[model samples]
Target: MLEEDLLYVLALQRVKGIGDINAKKLISHCGSAKNVLKEKRQTLEKINGIGAFTIKHLFDSNNLIEAEKELEYIQKNNITTFYFEAENYPEKLKHCIDAPILIFKEGNFDLSNRPIISIVGTRKITSYGRYFCEKLISDIKQYNPIIVSGFAYGVDICAHKAALKNKLTTIGVLAHGFEEMYPKSHKKYVSEINKNGGFFTDFWHNDSLIRENFLKRNRIVAGISEATIIIESAEKGGSLVTADIANSYSRDVFAVPGRSSDNLSKGCNDLIKRNKAAILTSANDLIEMLNWDIETKKEHIIQKQLFVELDETEQLVYDFLVDEGKELLDIISLNCELPIYKTTTILFNLEMKGVVKPLPGKLFEAI
Candidate 1:
C-alpha cells in the first residue's frame, strides 16, 4: 500500500471499538480507509452492524496523528506492511473473516505457491514431542514446505529449528510488536529466523505484550497455513486455541496421538475423540491428507505409453482413471462398478507397474 493510504489504515486500526472485521466492513462501504475516516457518523451508522458506538470515535483527529507516527516508524525501519486486500498478503489468511486488516512482515521468505503448515504445542515439550516434531519436518522436507509457528517455547521453537536445519523457510509469528521481544532469551534466535524465513505480527511498534496478546496472535498462526499440527499439548493450552481457530477457518487440523495416561497428550487425544482433528501419526498422514504428495508429483513430468499391459478389469479401471485424471478410491470403485477390495487390488497392481499412485485422502491418479 502507498504511504498516504497506510497512514489511514494505521489510523483505522487505532480506532477504539473498531477491529479487523469492522474495519473491513467500513473500508468495503467507503471504498478506502481515507474515505472511512472522512465519512459522516450518521452515514456510517446507516450500515448494518455499524452501531452509533462504533462510529463514536470515527472522527477522532488523534487517530490520524498517531497513525502518522506509526507510519514514520514503519518507513524508517523499512518494515513491510500487508494490506488485507493487497495481492502480497498471505492467500489462505485472506479468506478468514476475522483476519487482521494489516500485518507487518519482517522476512525475505517467498510465500507464493508454497504449502505452509503451522506446528504448535505445549511450551513444556517432552522428549517424545520433540522427537515427533523434528521427524515430522524431516519427513516432509522433500516437499520444501514452509513451516510456521508462534516462536515461543516447546513445539513452536522446535518446529522452527527443524525447518532451519532442513534448509526450509520458517516463520515466527510474534505475540508482541517489533519493538518488544517476549521471553527475551529468544532474541538470539531472531537473526537466524530472519535469515531463514522471518517474523510476522499485526501489533504496532508500541503495542504492549500481555496474556491476551498471545491469544489474539493465535489466529494468524492458525489462518496463515493450509494445516495446523499440534505435536503435543496439555489438557488446556494456547496450542489448543490455535487448533480450534484453524478448524473454525475450515482448514485441516491434525493432532498427534499419545497414550491415554500421558498428560501432555490429553488435549490432542481429546481433539481426536471429539472429531475436531484427524489423527496424525507421521508426515505421510499429513502429506496424504492435504494432497501434498499429489502436488509434488505434479511438479514432475511423466511419460505415457499406449501399449501398457492390462487385463480386463485393470484396463477398465485404468481407462476410467486416465479419463478422470484423478479420483478418490471410493469414487473410482463406484464408477468402475467394482468391489472396493477388487479395485484396491487392481490399483496396487497398477502402482507396482508405475501406472497409478495412491495419494492421501484416498485419492489416486493414472501416471
Candidate 2:
C-alpha cells in the first residue's frame, strides 16, 4: 500500500502550480498535504507564501482534477513515487536545500547502496574522448560502482554504453519526465536501462523538459555521486555544472587531462589547474583515490600468478604495461628484456587475445 505521507507528498508535487518553496511552507503550516488540502482559505492565507492568489488556485476544482489525473498517470506508468521521508528516498538528496518533495523512478536497482560516480563531459566528444571513456569505465567496473550521467550524446551515451557493457547498474537522471524521453534516438537504450537499471527525475510524468530542468537535474547527479569525473569537456559545457555542484557538496572531483590545444580538453585541464579537481591519467589513479574496497590487491596477486603462463617475452611486455600506462611500441621494446622485433610481435598477439589494447602512437594498455 502507498503510505499516507508519500501519497500526500506526491499529491502536493503533482499540483498544477505549487513549487518547492510554497510546498514547504504549506507542509510546514498544515503538517501534511492531506491536511493542507482540507484547510480553509483563511488558514492557508496565514502561511507565508499562501496568499489570496494561492488560496484561490489551491481550492480551484480544476486544480484538484489535474492532481487526480497526474496520480492516475503515475499509477498507469508503474513508476515508484518517493517522498523525502520514504524508506526508498535517496538519503543524500534528502539533505539538499532544494530537495524535491517527491521523486519518480522506474527501475529495480537500489540507489542507496552502490557508490555513485558521475561521468560527464562535452557533448562534442572526440575519438580520444570516446576511447578514454570506454577504457576508464571498463577498468572501474571491477570496483562495482554505480555510474551516473545525463542521457545526452557523446560522453554521456558512451558512459552508459560502457556501464551496460560491463554489466554494471547505471542510473540516467532525466531533466524531464517519463512521459517522453528526450532525444528520441536514445529511446531504445533508455528502455533497456529501465529494464536493467533505472531512470530518475524530480518532475512528474507530464512535466516539460525545459532549460531550467537540466540545471536542476545536474544537482541530483552531483548530490548522488561520491565523486564526479569529467572525461572531456569544452570550456562552457554542462559537465562543469555537475563538477561545481559536486565540489559544493564536498565530493571529490577528478578530470582527465587532455592536450591543451584540444578544445574538448580545455574544461578538464582548467578544472585541474584551478584546483577544483585532481588530474586523472589512469583508472588506477581513481581507484586509489577513492580507496575502493574492491579486492584489487588480491587481483594483482592473481594476475601475477596468471602471468607465469605467458612466454618470457609476453610476460615482459605485460609487466611493462602494468607498471606504465603507455602506447608507444618503441617504448615497450626499449623497456622490455627482449629485442624490438620479438616484443612487437608478442604485443600484437596479446592485443588480439583481449589482454591489452593498442592506443594511438603504438601505446598499449592492459585490458
Candidate 3:
C-alpha cells in the first residue's frame, strides 16, 4: 500500500467510536479511507449503522496526527500490514464479518497453510491439558497445519513450543501492541516464535494492556482459523469466549473432554454438553472432522494404461497426485490451484477413466 493510503487507514483506525465493521462500511461506501475522511458529515450520516456518535470523531485532526506517528513507527519496525480488501490478507480470516480491517503482523510466518487451527484454553492449564496440547500438535505435525494461540500461559505456550519442536508453523495472536510484550517473561521466547511463525495484533503501538483488551483480541484468535480447540478451561474464561466467537463465525470448535470432577474441565464440558463443540479425543478426531488425511495409500490400486486421455484440468490434478503419491481432496485442490468443486469433478472423471481411485478419509491416489 502507498504511504498516503496507509496514513489514512491508520487515521480511520484511530477514530474513537468507528471500529472495523464501521470502518469497512464507511470505506466501502466512500471507496477508500481517504475518501471516508474527506467526505462530508451529511454524506456519512446517510450511511446506515454509522450513527452520530460513531462519526463524531471522524474529522478529528488528532486522529490524523496519531496515525502519522503510528505509520512512522510501523515503517521503522518493519511491521507487515494486511488490509481487509487485499489479496495478501489471510484468506480464511477474510471471510469473517468482524475481522480486523487492518492487521499488523510481525514475523516471518507464511499464512498459506491450510487447515489452520486455533488452540485456546485457561491460562491456568492443568497437566492433562498440557499433555494433550503437546501430543496433539506432535501427532498432526505431518499435515503441516499452522497452529494458532494467544501467547499467554499454559496451553498457549505449550502449544507454541510443541509446534516448534515438531517444526510446524505457529502463530501467536496478541492483545497489546508490538511495543509492549505481555507477561514480560514470554519475551524470552519471542525471537523463536518470530522465526517459526509470528505474532498478529490489530492494536497500535504503545497501546496499553487492559483486562478488556484480552477479550477484544479473542475475535482475531477465533476468526483467523478454520477451527478452534479448547484444551482446558473453567466455567468462564477468555478461551471459552474464543470458542463462542468461533461458533458465531460458523467455524468448527473442538473441546478435549476431561473428568467431570476437574474444575478446569468445566468450561469444555459445558461447551460439549451445549453442542457448541465437538468432543475432541485425539488428533484423529480433528483430522477426520477437518478431512485432513495423511494416510498415503489404500489396500491396492487399479493400474491404468500409460496413455489415458485427459484434459488440462484433469491433467493438473493427476500430475499432482502422481507426484504427491496420495493427498486429501482439499490438499489436492490447493496444490493444483483448483477449486474443491472443480477438483472433485476432475477426480470423479479420472476415477471413471480408471486412472485414479478414492481411498478412505477423502484421500485420492494415482492408479
Q: What is the lDDT for 21 in model 2?
A: 62
Clashing residue pairs for model 2: 327-362, 327-363, 327-364, 328-363
Per-residue lDDT of model 2, residues 146-242, tens digit only: 8889998889989999999998988899999888888789998976787668888997787889999888899888877778899999898799998
lDDT of 1 by residue, 1-367 (tens): 7889999999999999998999999999999999999888889999999889888887889999999999999999989999999999999999999999999999779899899999999999999999999999999999999999999999999999999999999999999899998778888889998998999999998897999999889999999998999999999999999988987877788999999999999999999888778899999888766766765544331344454677899889988986786677889999999999999999999988777876434567777
TM-score of each: 0.82, 0.73, 0.81
Instruction: List per-prediction Cα lDDT, in the order shown.
Output: 0.89, 0.78, 0.87
lDDT of 2 at 203: 76
RMSD of each: 6.2, 14.1, 7.5
Question: Any runs in candidate 3 off by more than 4 Å, and if so which?
Answer: 294-367
lDDT of 2 at 106: 84
Candidate 2, overall lDDT? 0.78
Best model per TM-score: 1
User: Hey, what RMSD does candidate 3 come out at?
Assistant: 7.5
What is the descending lDDT order? 1, 3, 2
Error of 3 at 337 (Å): 30
- Candidate 1 ranges beyond 4 A from true positions: 295-367
lDDT, candidate 3, 297-336, per-residue tens: 2222223434578898888888788777667788998988
